[model samples]
Target: MSVWAAVLALIIERVWGYPDRVYRILSHPVVWMGWVIGKGDETFNKPDETSFETGRLVGAVCLGAFLALVLVVTQPVARLFSALPGGWVFEAAVASSFLAQKSLGEAVARVAAALREGPIEAAREAVSHIVGRDTAGLDEAEISRAAIETLAENASDGVVAPLFYLVLFGLPGIAVYKAINTADSMIGHTSDRYRAFGWAAAKLDDVANFIPARLTALLIALAARWIPGAVPGGALRTARRDSIRHASPNAGWPEAALAGALGFGLGGPRAYKGEVLDLPAMGDGRRELDADDIDRALTLYRRLLDVLLGATVACAVVVWVV
Candidate 1:
């Protein structure tokens, strides 16, 4: 039943992403998590007074409390759903909220559409919504790279990771994963204020994502076999060769795989807060990316989603038979 819930969640999220009206009315679960994280920061992180060591200790405690709250809230809901007739439908809806397949595709597609229809500023503005890098001065190649990289990375964390947990431990698994991921997104950074206080969250997020990230690369590699002009062998080779070069242990796997599949260079000399990060370039291909490149990446991404769904359905079938 939980396996079926994972299947249905992917289908529902594919058909209709999270609704704006529902978001307006109840806000989002991630938003609620963010609010809690914010409160934790305000209450415990008095930057002017707390020492670095104390901040790290407090951060671990806060993360423990936040995860406890997530489990407490979700466990009852899961049990209630389990007891109800056709309860997996409701469970599927809730689980769908955690996956971002529809939203991420639409957002990245918008960047391509913007580049096609409007000024570079429009593309930059659209890309800004998805990526954290400074987009103000990005050219067409950079914008295309940013959109593709985002598609690859988010495909791992936002879609695969949540679904992985949901399939393994049902609603509670996904809820806990999302809580930890959201906390990391909110507080995990290198800024002086959050550096110490967010250490626990950042490390935990890395641990949680390690497996899913690699799985995502493998899925992308498999997906490439069907996409014209995509290279599955290249994806595997580049992922093996270049993924380790990234600063983040998990992000590079998918990014490098995507780069290799599409034959586009990525992860080179990105600037954040005026500091240049000359990360090693992945893939031995063209560096001058364009709108066509974005379109190709989106095509590959959509294909990857189909593969993921097909794989999920197959798993559910096997479970049913067993």
Candidate 2:
């Protein structure tokens, strides 16, 4: 049943996405999670008031509280749906709201479109929405690199990771993953205010992402094999060699796979806020990224989604039969 639910959710997300009207009325689960995290930060993350251990304790409590809240609400709802006729459809639609396959692709496509038709500033503005890096001083190549890198990395975060958890523990699994991801995005940083308090969120998110990130890279490599022009640069070898060089343990996997697939080098010395960090590059191919590269990345991402859909269908069939 859960396997079928995942398939239905993916289909809904790929076809219509979450509608703007529905969003206007209900906002999003992630937005609500963000609000909870924001309030927790405002209440518990005071720099002068709390010590590092205290901050860590508070973050743990907050994480626990949020997880409990989600389980409490969603479990009953899942039970309710299970009692009704074809109720998995409603449950699947709810699950689809948490997955961002179409939205991620569209957002990345907008960056590519902006780069192709607008000024460099416009492109920078478009990419900034999806990435955390400083985009103000980026050139065209840098801007394109940032956008493509985000596309690759978020293929894990926004899509694969949630689906991975869904298959393991159903809706509750994906919900908890999203909550942790939201908290990490809100507070997981090395800045003075967040260094202590965000540790738990950051570490927890890393653990949650560990398996799914590698799976995403594997899917990308598979897509490259079948999808023409997807990985002209040798994704498997490049990923094996350079993936560990990234600042993040998980983000590097997909990024390396993508860089290898696109026949380009990504990463290496990007700015966050105003600070430039000297990071290692991923691939040994082209460093001169362009709008066309963004398009290519999107193409690969779409193919990867098809791969995921196929996998979901096969898994669902097995589960139903068995």
TM-scores, one per candidate: 0.98, 0.97
Q: What is candidate 2's lDDT per residue for 49-135, written digit by digit as tens? A: 888888788878877887788898888888888888998888898999889999999988888899889888899999999999899
Quote the positional error of residue 173 for candidate 1 in Å. Answer: 0.7
Candidate 2 residue spans exceeding 4 A from truth: 230-233
lDDT of 2 at 139: 91
Query: All models: lDDT?
Result: 0.93, 0.88
- Which of the numbered candidates is closest to the native, going by highest TM-score? 1
Candidate 1 structure, TM-score to reference: 0.98
Clashes of each: 0, 0
- Give the lDDT of residue 45 in candidate 1: 84
lDDT of 1 at 191: 91
